[model samples]
Target chain A: MQEELIRKHRWFWAWADDREEAWLREMAQQGLHLGKAAPLGEYFFVRGEPRDDVYRLDYVPMSKKDEHYYQLFKDAGWEHVGEMMGWQYWRKLATDSQADEIFTDNDSKIQKYQRLLAILTIFLPVLIINVTNMGVFSLREKYPWIIGLQVFSIFLLVFYSVVLLRILFRIRMLRRR
Target chain B: MAGSDVRKYLPLTESTYYILVALSEPMHGYGVMQKVEKLSEGTVTIGPGTLYGAFGTLEKAGLIRMVKEEERRKSYLLTARGRAVLKEQITRLAIMNRNGQGLLGILD
Candidate 1:
């Protein structure tokens, strides 16, 4: 029997949304269409006829009136496939007359990154507090395991910094053009 | 609109200008998007993301208000302040257009 569904695992950072969109489009062309998305980089696909559909990802904070948001997109010809952690996955059949974008103006496009940046920065205070209270430098002599914990903390801090910088860079690039 | 208020929204961007003009009648976000395209003669297209965000901003600024809600769709109309702002914008555009009327040959 042919498999009707397949699960693919992939990870994409917040700044690499375009790369993720391209990958989804490629999967569609290969007779696999995204049917569901799960957290921690899990995507389930359904086998289907080959298509040249375009996929777009938009990030929006959870709102009280999300139904209106969905309806607007539906009317605008975008099919809201799935949403994960405020990231909306939209798909539409490719048409020659229309551009593959859900944001027509630069300000709204920049606002998308600004929203992502806000979510990422909310962790800044918590990260700072955890590092300061750890006092791992002085405790390293008393407990060797604290060194490993401290290293992990530094690694997380570095990862957060890079993500923040990339999002800011994207905003600046959008503003310049 | 007051002098200060008019100045704040005078130089509307292309999308914002078209959106405000479209809100002259009560219409939902998608309706506004379609009307904008038609009014601009296919020159401008407002994607759903942009239109959704604009609705929030315009509503917050008191330039547009929800007049009715049908199912999940909310229709909005221009507030008095929004109409005033649009008027000011059109006047500004007319002046600018007149100033550049006979200067096309200056461009390379």
Candidate 2:
């Protein structure tokens, strides 16, 4: 048997973690298993025989320093595959009886999205400050590089705002359920 | 805590109630999950994500505390405040159950 490593590209916003999980499960069904996930939307996969596996992602920001956190998941029968940018990747065999859901209730599911929203909230103000500085201080005229930085900050601000809104909507939807 | 204050946390959700009951004795995260499942007869299952998030919230609310760590797993048990809240919730649930059963008998 030989190991085949492939890099796959996928963009997943914080609120769309379920989409990323679905994509990973689809890859597993096609005999490509995720090995390592890197920063900036790159996923490394190893080729293997097709199998039914359930992939789940949990936004655990401080889990890198929390051994007990990972151990709990491990003891619950989830295999810790890897961590990329505060997201923990876990997989378990697709079984016949129980459904594969990391959150059993709506309250906990809302909490997960709230955590993601919190992260976006933190960066939002910083991006706003950058945009304001460029506009008010006239830095774009003094420094040519400031123009590029301003444009990048504006893009990030829009992206973060969209993600934040989606997460808030998810929390509201969970509460209604 | 006063009875009224403890009442604020009453009507614990199914998952939270099972978790608090399981933590009546010292147990870690995974232990709580297993005990809850057994106590509910497989009717309720707390997944890792829910369990982890609940631990943080309950601990912050002074309802639970970490007792010790064995091999990377941390054991937790209810605090005095937790017991007070749980007791209040049980009282509320008992009243609700009695009313429901009485209404059911009338319907029958």
Candidate 3:
């Protein structure tokens, strides 16, 4: 028999990972364990007995998914929940002997943010180049919709810059600790 | 690699320290985690994330290299540089231990 799954929609910012973890843990406490997260901001959960579970969101650095990476985490007992937008969701039932946290030291945590920064640095430039290559300025005279595309591209450039800055600030704060 | 190169990784993190020590024999990620816990007598625990990240950084620095891969698990062994780095760390730790022997003396 198929277990009925519950779906929920919510959004989280890159800097608000702790908030995301809290919200997911709360969902687990209410017996709605995460089954999969897909299509962005949509969380599918499997209804089960209410229990304490810890959720962690990890950003894998490489563009390609490494099975070895998952296997290592499995070795340490973190069950892979689902991934959305390159952030891996890991769940571990709360236990006295097992560790609740995923990354142990500040250096590893800093490296996580560093990996995110690397992705942004790679994509942000590609996006700008692609937008410019679209000839938005020249095409706008013939195609008015090109102006809207230009505006959206500019907005994304700014959004990417802001997110980059926020992550840099977060890394600095972690170093201070 | 002793004068400055080895000292660059001096004062290794507890996890890194235990990891290098454990990799005296090639071991996989899960093996390293279990060995670290035992070596530290349950005091220092290396979660998978830290260990995996350390493997990347260490491998990149030529301090550790993957010697075997099987069943989706890669086993790593310390390089000559890794051994030098570990020795430098031990020297510093030994000095600290000697200078702070009062605690051990008092306890004994």
Candidate 4:
């Protein structure tokens, strides 16, 4: 599954699975229009005209009231300005206070930290295993101690991956909230 | 509680004020959006995401509640608290307007 996703896109949004794809399809069905096709989570960003600003709405769906707010903003002369995956929206503020609201309380930084952990979880174990494999080949005998350490490291890595996956799921749920 | 009044609740955002004003009618999400835009003279365009975020907050605050739902769409109405807030805002605006006009000698 991962291989297929990597083939289609240079980067995977996170992971690929049939269920994930189905849910993404449902999100698209709700109100989103994808500019380009890739994989379940992989999205291609595109820039459009000044009138119709392009945005790739991720799995996150905007609420009904926020939709009203955006319309009000658009009515107030805030044109389609820019787009980002689910986070960025073109807004023109009537008041300085309104503009202040945009910069405050962004969770993206924390999300990025979590993503860093995910990358470590994915790569760290692989590194340990490759190093152990090389050592075993050079030694010409699988030392019992080294074998036990390698097995333990692999198990730890698998456990770390599961925990990272859980954290990612929690973040997704928070986005829904 | 249902009639015209201006007190008890206060400190409403412009978006919330407009939303409550629009919800005075039986308007759905798109309907409320349209009315707000029309009333504001096309000065505000609330995206769908932001609308839902506000709805979640307002509904949780007991200022608004979901009145109807159809398929994936929903309509919300102001609660008594929401109406009170709107009334208070109106009274405050009125007072400020009167004082400013008197001070500026703009009233006839």
Could you tell me every candidate's TM-score relative to the true structure? 0.93, 0.91, 0.89, 0.45
DockQ of 2: 0.75
Report the lDDT tens digits of candidate 1 across residue range A56-125. Answer: 9999878633789999999888998998888899999877455567988999989989888888899988
Give RMSD (Å) of candidate 3 vs. truth: 2.9
Which residues of candidate 3, in runs, are more than 4 Å off? A61-64, A96-98, A127-146, B103-108
Candidate 2: where are CA atoms >4 Å away?
A96-99, A137-149, B105-108
DockQ each? 0.81, 0.75, 0.73, 0.08
* Ranking of models by TM-score: 1, 2, 3, 4
Q: Model 4: residues >4 Å from true position, as ranges?
A: A1-41, A44-53, A56-177, B1-9, B103-108
Interface RMSD, per-candidate values to 1 decimal: 1.2, 1.3, 1.3, 7.3
Question: In model 2, what is the error at residue B88, expressed in angstroms?
Answer: 1.6
Task: Please give, for residues B1-108, the per-residue lDDT of candidate 2 as tens digits.
Answer: 347678788778999999999999999999999999999999999998899889989999999999999998989999999999888888878889998987996796
Candidate 1 stretches greater than 4 Å from native? A1-3, A63-65, A96-99, A136-141, B105-108
Error of 1 at A90 (Å): 0.6
Pairs in steric clash, model 3:
none
True contacts kept of 3: 0.84
Query: Please, what are the lDDT tens digits per residue for candidate 4 over residues A1-177?
Result: 221211123333333322433443443344332344443434443322232222222232233124444553444344443333433333232343423122112243234335445445667667677767756664786678876666676677676667667657756765665
CAPRI quality of model 3 = medium
Model 2 pairs in collision: none
